[model samples]
Target: MAGRGEMPMRPARPGPPMQYRGPPPMARARVEPIDREKTCPLLLRVFTKVGGHHQNEEFAVRGKEPKDEVQIYTWKDATLRELTDLVKEVALAARKRNARLSFAFVYPDKHGRFVVKEVGSTFSYGHGRGDDAKSLAELGFQIGDYLSVAIY
Candidate 1:
């Protein structure tokens, strides 16, 4: 104890040295590869329009969907580029040299109302703007969801 105006000093405590652990386990986890041979393909309902995408109001009512429909049996691992090639097979407008294809997912919301959400886009005959590598699973595609393609 100090008798005057001097301050008291405390003893120092020792602790273990800090170590740098890399990224967390979840961050380093890898996605398992899916086997297409044994897995059955899902039926994907697609609608196409030459100019622009179909409005959400068009799909508001049941049995009133757009007239042009294409059914595709594909896996969830399918990329946008693969889907674009498949669309070109049936959609003549999408086969143009400089045509553009915009993709959107149509699904029912919490209130059972249909909603249209644009996912990605790709070019017809040339290199895409990076969206070509995005897979259906990466775009939050569901089994019952419908795909709408706008050809421009």
Candidate 2:
């Protein structure tokens, strides 16, 4: 029998663990890819250009001219992030306008129906952080008729 600390090396030694030559994995993937060209889901839900037509001033007084709504549908799978990004994008696009314009962060109701917050600026209507109706509603333009959400 082997005594304490004496003649205990009966088994042969094994080689050291192999070195991992491969590169370390990316740092937890990117936090979020910055897709400059990518538009979010909500952009599809845009339903702007509701009920208007290019007509002469003389024709408007007669009320005989047919009007059309440049309507759009609600983006079906608009995530909050996508919606917010789209709203901001639209607002930026409005830069060409002489006056500041409005956009809405339109969403659905509790009963699963779509609803528009107001026809105002995104600044005063949908602040995009949960509840910012005032900033959102401040939007002065309607994206679409209440019903004609341009289906993406």
Which predicted model would earn the best TM-score?
1
In model 1, which regions exceed 4 Å deviation? 1-31
Q: Would you estimate the TM-scores of all the predictions?
A: 0.77, 0.25
> By how many angstroms RMSD does model 2 differ from the true structure?
18.0
Report lDDT per candidate. 0.90, 0.34
For model 2, what is the C-alpha lDDT against the true structure? 0.34
lDDT by residue for model 2 (1-152), tens: 78888886576668887888899765532223334346342223243332221222312233342242222333432233333344444444333323223334344446654444433332212335432333211222233223222111
Candidate 1 C-alpha lDDT tens digits along 1-152: 76588888766667877788987665422335669999899999999999999998889988888899999999988989999999999999999988999999999999998899999999997775649988898888888999999999
Instruction: Report backbone clashes per prediction.
Output: 0, 27
Report model 2's TM-score to 2 decimal places: 0.25
